[model samples]
Target chain A: MAPMRIDQLTPGTVAHIVAIDLDELGERRLREHGLDEGVEVELLHRAAFGADPLAVRVGNACVAMRRSQAAGVTVRVAQRLEAAE
Target chain B: MSEVMTAPVVALVGNPNAGKTSLFNALTGARQKVANYPGVTVERKAGTLTLPDGSRAELIDLPGAHSLEPRSPDEEVTRDVLVGAYAHERVPDAIIAVVDATNLASQLRFVLELKALGRPMVVALNMMDLAERDGFFIDYEALARELALPVIPTVAVRRRGLEAVIAAARDALNAAEISAIRSADAPAMLVEAIGDMRGHQRQARDIAAKVVSGGDANQMTRQIDRLVLHPVSGPVLLAVILFLMFQAVFAWATPFADAIEGAIGWAQGIVMTSLPAGPVRGFLTEGLLGGVGAVIVFLPQIVILFAFILVLEQSGYMTRAAFLMDRLMAGVGLSGRAFIPLLSSFACAIPGIMATRSIADPKDRLTTILIAPLMTCSARLPVYAVIIAAFIPDRTVGGLANMQGLVLFGLYAFGVVGALAAAWVLRLTVTKGAGGGFLMEMPKYQLPAIRDLAIGIWQRAWAFLRRAGTIILVSTMVLWVFASYPKAPDGVSQVDYSIAGRIGAGLEVVFAPIGFNKEISIALVPGMAAREVAVAALGTVYAIDADDEELLEVELADRLRGAWPLPTALAFLAWFVFAPQCISTFAVTRRETNGWRWPIFMFSYLFVMAYLGAGATYWISKWALGG
Candidate 1:
């Protein structure tokens, strides 16, 4: 999966969180918040104002994340196609 | 040798991830209090360690620092304390320069700078186990020779290698004519030298590297990281975890909280039966039991809440949550740096305000300090628990979620929303400018050490008890005096004419628009002192009207249901969410910001928001519920 900017993900888009490119402190922090990898995620909402942080749904919870940190997260957009298209 | 002797005072200093607090807790046990250095708002934690030879040495834990030169208030404390310039105390007899052995290539720059301070010192190469697991081999003798200081490998969390740490400290304390290491004038020199020394990193790694190995652990951590940091699953897991924590606060604490309530009622009955009608009886029943007992009943919930917080903090999951939320915070005109302080606010505002020192920008720090009190603290738990239990129906929401926990989570969510909105307004009207950028260090994932977690929880419990015993004691006595005297006319209960009742009645006029009765109005006054006192105040007022002692929550709830209405209860909860912070928060804000302007701004804005929010809640609920 190639890395996608957080803005690319939509409300129903399912993607795998690939990697967090934070420094030692950032990596430590990402791990502490339970945001490592192999987890499925969906974009729930985005801020309508300045520096819009994305509201993301992982599992059953929702969190708002910054774009800088989100940029480090690689994702593969889940493909949804009609059964007989 | 009949000579005078003195025990050495050792100060432990390190970066935030260097396990300094764990080392301090390991050395001192439970004999420590968190305080600030005089004239500086940074936390100063000190404790005494009894050496093996019957000598007692004082251990101080300074604020975490990246370098000796200060940028934030916390780093300044580290620098000031190291150089003997802080107001509260002079420099320690020796400095324990704690470094994360795993990240030594970066952390050592600070260690090198500290060594240059020429203070009697020892290098505590903490987390050596993690370093070796990462394939780093440190030769302690080589590093010790290079720095000309005693180097000891320490796994502070496990209490391993402490004997070596203590021994090294003793050796440094006893040594004579130690060479004065030259100080680095600029941070760049130390950075450059640290970079140059990277080639020798393998040789400088402490301990027999293989002895502290964790080959499988790294692989496991990597695997766990995949799911936890996943974009798809991470947020869901975080929400579930938080939901469970809130549920535990409600479901698990109820039985214990009920038991405490029963015990208080039983004790109240005994006192009422044993004493003849007089001030003594009134004092025992109303002042002592009514005020203090009411607050104490909520201890179970607080303990449970702390248990979850401590576990999360100890397991090192909190930083990841901060990282995940940074963007959200930035979106609302807050720096990601506000995450730690705001998280700490869930426990209490005092530490949260103090923690703002981690934020380098003055405006951001002030903004965080101003809004932290809005983040529903544990003290408010008693208030919320009592009110929610009384008014809200006990049922499940969304078929699977507990209604009570959802309400609790909603309250927290309200606080977060209110905080961001306040920050947004403040940024627009008060402090308008692009401020500092976000820079936070995340630590590696680790299983929470039980001993360290236990110690942290114990410290919080002890602090809570101490506050209950002292401040609550004095305030309750004063309130008792106000509520006791100026007897009512014949055929009326004295409480109707008592100062508290009169004041409550007077305040009710102002709050009546918001659906608050006299009793609730009175509760809000002392509540400004601290949130828990509001519960006690209700107990004290309601005791005068009851035929027998009832559980404070039950009696208060029943009283509100009969006298006021659902709108009033909901409005009161809304008021608490945006109320001008308790007095202690203001005191801390003043100390933290070093002025009254920010505190004044905070109070004025919160007061406005509280009134508006409460008024809106009252009207909307009244119209909606057909009140």
Candidate 2:
């Protein structure tokens, strides 16, 4: 299976970022927040309305970013952690 | 170091949630000075810190920046000041890079970047308590040895290791080789990594791996996020918190507001009875007391509102609220960051406009400032109250809600709708630019410290009071002169004979089509000073005795009902919903935007809205009511 964009990962799935493709500013913002190649990311929650912005845990900080921005980040799935736990 | 006589300067730099502010407060207590940087609106916060040796040093808290590379205006200020490129602030003798221990891997990236600057610096590992609570022990000594710097573990809120941190910073500043150290060239790799975010991040993680021992995940934050970020419960809880905040602003603040109002009234009474009737009495009672007192009465509401805002921000729930509201705000081309500022505008637009500094995107901040006055601030309450009391019947409609209450709610709803519409139009028009992204960190929730919260509230309250004393005070005195002199020839009614009266008569021609009479036109003049003063202005225009405020309200409502038609009263309410009536708001808009162009545009647009809205209300109501 191909590596998926971060926004498509399941809520509890762990992934390693493979590539980030955004405009200069957007890419810089993501990198400054410690989201880069080989960094671990976990999809945690989606906002209620449309779920366009996903709350993902990167390193020890939880970041809120829109799906459009999240779509630029390609990640290889690591494992699916149980959401209930 | 350059100035041998002056106090040594120490700058505290960190990421946004690294407890830098809390540490600053702990270090400096109440001795702090806040001012804007020379050419920008970013705040320059400096305080006097007494070091362990009892000598003082100037501690400045630079704005939080993710890296040395600038992304926003705030980050630009940080980078400029740190590199000694900003003309106003000198380069600091020593730097304290505050890093959150719980999130060391990411935060240390900033520290490493600061280290690359080759400045005399120490690492203050903050939030150590939170790290330990999450089952992690950071070897600070090993980390210090690895990085070749002093690392002090600290819990800022608890004031742990603060002295040690200060002592280390003092030692760094006092070292004779500090200047020599800075002059030495940085390593090639470190210089190359300054602009490379990934390189610094990777280097930070390698250091973190060496010193961090264990990590049982922070289950507390995860469990709370599960509920707080829930699709259904999240917004529901947000709604509940908002409801409580508004309730507190209105309900809990009434008694204090009344006390303040009563005190001012008593002072006016004392001036009236003790002195013979003359210009002195009028100046004291009417100009000073009536004008400034009205604006000051809203201070309690402002304080209460700010208390809730500070608590929400410090507790880390503001970002969560912003996350929930981001979509709704985006519908009008704004990010969730606009939510807090817009919410603050409900209390007053001055602080609301000031709060926009946190919104990194310039276009988004300007748009938010432009629509802030449309939030139906507490200042509009007095005008709305008087108008609703006079026009809307005091009875329940549909057996569930009061008729008067419904009309007030409708007016509030109308203002909100208007603001949203204005924002939508603005984004497409002048403010159109690169759409800003919503990239914010959701920090782990922490209990807000009482001392820090109190200090924040006090600073805001002081700013509000200072504005009241300066701009509001001057405008009221000027209005008093315009309304008082050229006293009426006996029986002519003083307000009609005054200069303000003639100006009102002149303005009546333009306002006539909107169903406003001469008194309404006259009141609109002083109403520009503040929205609530319109009520008092109307009292003056009608020649009513303003002895007792309670009786004045009753007498004013009764008089208004007798003088104006139903359509006229309703039209007046509609006019206030969009009018840019407060001078202080306009002044603040100019200051925040750093120019007159945006404030001018804001005034012109709002005036157009008020005119069209009032005219429409009058014509439709006249046709329906057969007036």
Candidate 3:
């Protein structure tokens, strides 16, 4: 499957992180939070009204990140149970 | 062995919301005082822990960082202290790397990076209870074996498995070669070693996968997230929470405020009855009892205000709040992390500015600090109250909300709008830099720990009293001297010939454009001390009777109504919305920014804004009313 930016995922979409193209510092911070390749990320939802920053679940932690930041992260879509496998 | 060190130092490092601070409080108990890292505003928190064998270890809680690489001044301080490069802080004899057990894969990377430094260290797998509740069956022993270091499982909030961690720390401190990691050469070498974090991440994942963990996703957290992160309901919920918090600060705290007011009044009555009528009496009854006591009266409101912030923060709601505010703030080029600091500024700008130290990006922190004083703090309540009381009628609208209340609400809204506009301008002009997109770790939702909340409130309340006693008291006395001196030139109401009156008369020329007369010009000098002081200042200048402190607000409002024109009164209200901030706010800005540049800039900008805003309001109101 073609990898898409994580920000493209809608609520209920679970994707496996393929790559992160952010700055070194930001990429390192994401890696420290278990957003490395093959880690499963579930797009939670966007914030109310503005809907700019998106929330996602990664490794039992809920992360709130800007859409611009999420765009730097590439992911392959998968079912939640499939990603668990 | 390099040497046996006295008073062994241990650095506790971790990622944000990793339970590092919770473990520190549990380990240190009550013996902790936060001071500044020399020449900077970032806090240096150290506490003493007595080992079972009577040996003492000083534990320093380092600010959370992503890795050994430093990004901003705040993170640089942490990295420098770790590498012994910080000139003021000693490199620790041992390092305690606290990691959250629930998400081992994410936290283990920082552990691996810190391990490369070759420090005598132990890993505290904190929040073990939460991990277990989430069905994360972590083989901490296997993880320990993989790192070849002691891994102690701990529940920081509950203090579970605390003894094992303490035992490990003591052993690491007492072991040989404490100086190995303390050497200057190790940091540069280690930085190079950890440069390839992709390799480290791979290794960390391998170990985490092998720790024989049967992972069970938390159903409770997932369910809660569904509600809190709902597109429609999320922001609505946030607004409701914030509204309740502000409303409670006023409603829930009134009884306590009244009690405090009654107590101070009683004490003042006793003193006034006994003392002879002279300058000593005036100083005691008015300056100390009335002026300083006025600031202290807001303690109940302050306490209630911070209680909400502390609970929201510790309960994991603040991160959610940040997420909610991100898009709104991102329009102005600010990250989500600036949310809490700006929120706290509504109570007082001092802590709000200090809270920015946790933001690792210096530009974001600076931007947040610059806009903090515009949040309309509790100290501005009195000025607003006196104005609204004097001008706005006390009728009910829709039989629920008072006319006066709706006006007050409009004023609050105006202050907030002004703050947002100011922040946007500041970010675009000065202090503009590469904007970092918001990314924050969302900690699991949990009930706030009572002990931690109690300690937090106690510390803030104490600081409030201390500041009231020193700075507020001194400024009050200075105001009194300015009002009472020069003997009234033997006939002119003890003020017309005084230094303060003369200065106010001369300053009226500059202030006249904003519709301020001599009395208001006089009040402005003392209002620089604090926003609330302007009320009492104007009250005294107008020669209101001083028999009862309780009647002061009422008397002042009537005196103001009979004296000033309605347009001039409206102008004064506009002035306070963007008033040139209290001296203490500027003082805090100086400390937080570590320079005079930002403080001077802040004062000048706010002064100009207040002057223009007041003038516009006065002329507009006059036109509308056909005055």
Task: Please report, in order, the local distance difference test score of every candidate based on alpha carbons.
Answer: 0.72, 0.83, 0.81
Candidate rank order under lDDT: 2, 3, 1
Model 3: lDDT of residue B200: 81
Best by TM-score: 3
Q: B1-627 in candidate 1: lDDT tens per residue?
A: 225565557889887868998998888887887776666566678888776676778899988876665668888777766666666775576788898776554466567667656667899989877767767667767777766788898999889888788877766656522533223332444344334332322332332232223332234444454565556565677778877887888789888878987887788778878888778887788778878887887777778878888777766677656655666677667876687788788889888898888887788887888889898898888888878878888898779977777888899889889999888877776767775655445466677777777877787888888888877766776777777777677788766788988988899899888888888887777777788888888877776655444533355656655666788888888998988848988888887777898888889988989999999999998999886
CA lDDT, candidate 2, residue A43? 92
Over B1-627, each residue of candidate 3 has an lDDT whose tens digit, in order, gives 435566889999998888888888889887888777776767788999888798888999998887777655666787888887889997888999999888778778889888888788899998888888877788988999999999999988898878898899888876724344447677676666569788888888899889947766667777887787777777789877876676576567779878987887787678777887678877787777777766777788789988898898898889888988887788777888888888888878877887787676777788888888888787787787778879988788898666766776677678778877887888889977877778788888878778778877887788778867876677777877888787754445666677788899999999998899988998899888878778767756664233344443445578789889999999999999888759988888887777899999999998898899999999999999997
Clashes of each: 36, 0, 0
For TM-score, candidate 1 versus 3, the one ahead is 3
TM-score for chain B in model 2: 0.89
How far is B592's C-alpha from truth in model 2 (Å)? Answer: 5.4
- Using DockQ as the measure, the top candidate is 2
Fnat value of model 3: 0.83
Stretches of candidate 2 above 4 Å error? A79-85, B1-4, B176-193, B378-412, B526-570, B582-595, B619-626
Which runs of model 3 end up more than 4 angstroms from their true locations?
A: A23-26, A79-85, B1-6, B176-181, B360-362, B386-408, B432-434, B489-491, B539-566, B591-595
Go through the candidates in order and give each one's DockQ: 0.06, 0.75, 0.70
- By DockQ: ranked, best first: 2, 3, 1
